[model samples]
Target: MPDSLAAALTGLAFGLSLIVAIGAQNAFVLRTGLRRTHVLPVVAVCALSDAVLILAGVGGLGTLVDRHPAVLTVARVAGAAFLLGYAVVAARRALRPGAVLTAEDGDAAPARVWPVVATCLALTWLNPHVYLDTVVLLGSVAGTHGDARWWFGGGAVLGSLIWFTGLGYGARLLRPLFARPGAWRVLDAAIALVMVAIAASLLLGL
Candidate 1:
């Protein structure tokens, strides 16, 4: 295979590996997807945000980030606080235990667009793990591709788009399972746990 093709494949695999794990952003995306509220905008925000970060990484912003440890530190603090707050909200929803979904009628009125978009942006951008994965690690790896670094970045961006689109759209298939209030409660509880665990890891630097 050509160097470009090889680089692109490597980037795609590496990107998937980094993003496939359950994390704050994934959890938010999953919840939003299940609700079927503003799914397009949310998925777009996530994919586009990843594209920007991946491009920045390939463009050498990773070097600047490496030089400034304080940037990650600040992001870590803010991200942890945000995750904790979100966890509380998820916990509250879990406790309420009345939200249920249907094909014709959603759990409730769909949320306004901008707020959901904003939340998606924050969930994608505020997490320091995103930076570590897209900026530092991906960027560093792309650099090894030399002239093919942009191709590598493009592959990574493609992977992100594919993942988010599939996740957001495919979640509807689970609507039957989520039709029950108990299922929603269980989901919210799990989301709360994920958020709390991620926040704790960020705060404790584990």
Candidate 2:
């Protein structure tokens, strides 16, 4: 049990170490949470997608992904482009002082939950870095311990569930801060800047 606990703790550290970094998914989640729209579905999509990838990582599929350098490179560049596009939109939103940031404000028109869920899933699943983070990197690190691997896997998935949910839900607490139009601009601009910065880092190979 002590060994299990240690593995779990190590997994948690591994998961957090990889995911805690700034990226498109976190930025999108934060932006959506701040907008007070489709928060639950978004969070579910992110968490569930992580679960699948983590499972793949634990089952040794991550190593396969790691070997395919070409595929991973394509994904990284594509993902970075998507993130940069999002950064542009976020910046535009920041400039528009009266944007409501609701379902109505989006191009979907009908504003279905499925699209939000789909978007989050794609963002989480299609990105190559997630595999590197959870499957290859964390899996390689955790596989050193034979029986403790499960503990590590479980810990990593739980960390993801906890984080995406907290980040999605926790942003709600900032409602009052965003209520003030000035604060809203600040928050949106900050989100935009972070997104662009991450995108740049990815493109620049940093």
Candidate 3:
């Protein structure tokens, strides 16, 4: 394959590889999207985080993460714990009866943007798996390229933008369905189940 073609194809694959996995961050994005909540702030934080991590991965930080098995292990355990707590919260919300809905409450126009952005940043950064997957593993893989390092990182960032934007804003089309209180409960319960399953899998390595 030609160099440019090779770079783009490699980038596409790299981006897809880093995504397509279940995680709390993604679930939150989808939830917010369905609820027609804050969109730009959520998408921006997710995209920016992806760019930062991709850059770190391409710039040789992967070596440091690779050498620090203890760090990854600690992060994995901590992430699992966090997920467990979040899962319980989601389950509770799902099972609870919702308050009476009104036009004002369902408007979704009141969604705060900055706080949501901040929350996303914390969630993306705090998870240790982010480092392992984006900075370490993807970085190490990108390092194999002789002259396509930027291509690799760019591809990864593209993946992030696509996924995050899709999750955070794409669900707007389903707003009519998700606007219902019962829909929220159903979504929350589904999120909880997925989170619990992922947390257990991470803890058990199965």
Candidate 4:
């Protein structure tokens, strides 16, 4: 295989390794997808955001981030606060007995598009871990590719697109299970726990 192909493959593998984990962003995307609410926009936001970060990293933004510790510190604090707030919302939903998944033509209304978009943006942008993973780690890795770093970044970008698109669109398969109100409660409860745990970790600098 050509060196470019090798670099691209390495980037793809590394990106997947970094992204394919349980986290606040994935939890939100999964919930949104399960609800069948503005899936396209959410997936687009995630993929596009990752693409920008990866490209920026490949362009040497990682060094700047490293030089400025305060940037990540601010992001960490803000992200923790946001995650905690979201956890409260999730906990409330879980406690509400009426929190059921509405049918396609049910009386319940879907969430407003912009709010969901805003939440997606916050989840994507506020998390310091995203920068660490995409910008710092991936950028540092790409640097090893020398002239092929852009190709590596492209591969990482492609991996992100594939993952988010698949995750957002594929969550509907679980719709059958989430059809039950109890299932929704269980999911929301789990989301709440995950969010709180992540927030605690962030706040404690863990």
Task: List the candidates' TM-scores in order.
Answer: 0.95, 0.87, 0.85, 0.96
Better of 1 and 2 by TM-score: 1
Give the C-alpha miss distance for residue 127 in model 4, angstroms.
Answer: 0.2
Q: Which candidate, 1 or 4, would have the higher lDDT against the true structure?
A: 4
How far is 29's C-alpha from truth in model 3 (Å)? 0.4
TM-score leaderboard ranking:
4, 1, 2, 3
Q: Each model's C-alpha lDDT?
A: 0.87, 0.77, 0.76, 0.90
Flag clash pairs in model 1: none
lDDT of 3 by residue, 27-55 (tens): 87887676566767788888898889889
Considering TM-score, which of the candidate structures 2 and 4 is the better prediction for this target? 4
Per-residue lDDT of model 2, residues 1-206, tens digit only: 69999999889877887888777789778868876678888988888888888878888887888778887777778878877776777777789976634432432343577877776876786676787777788778778868888888999999999999999989878766665666766766887787677667677872
Model 1: per-residue lDDT, tens digit, 75-183?
Answer: 9899899989999988998888554444335646887999888878888888998888899999999999999999899899999999999998898899888777788
Name the better of 2 and 3 by lDDT. Answer: 2
Model 4, residue pairs in steric clash: none
lDDT of model number 4: 0.90
What lDDT tens digits, residue by residue, belong to model 4 across residues 142-199? 9999999999999999999989988988988988877678888898899999999988
Off by over 4 Å in 3: 99-115
lDDT of 3: 0.76
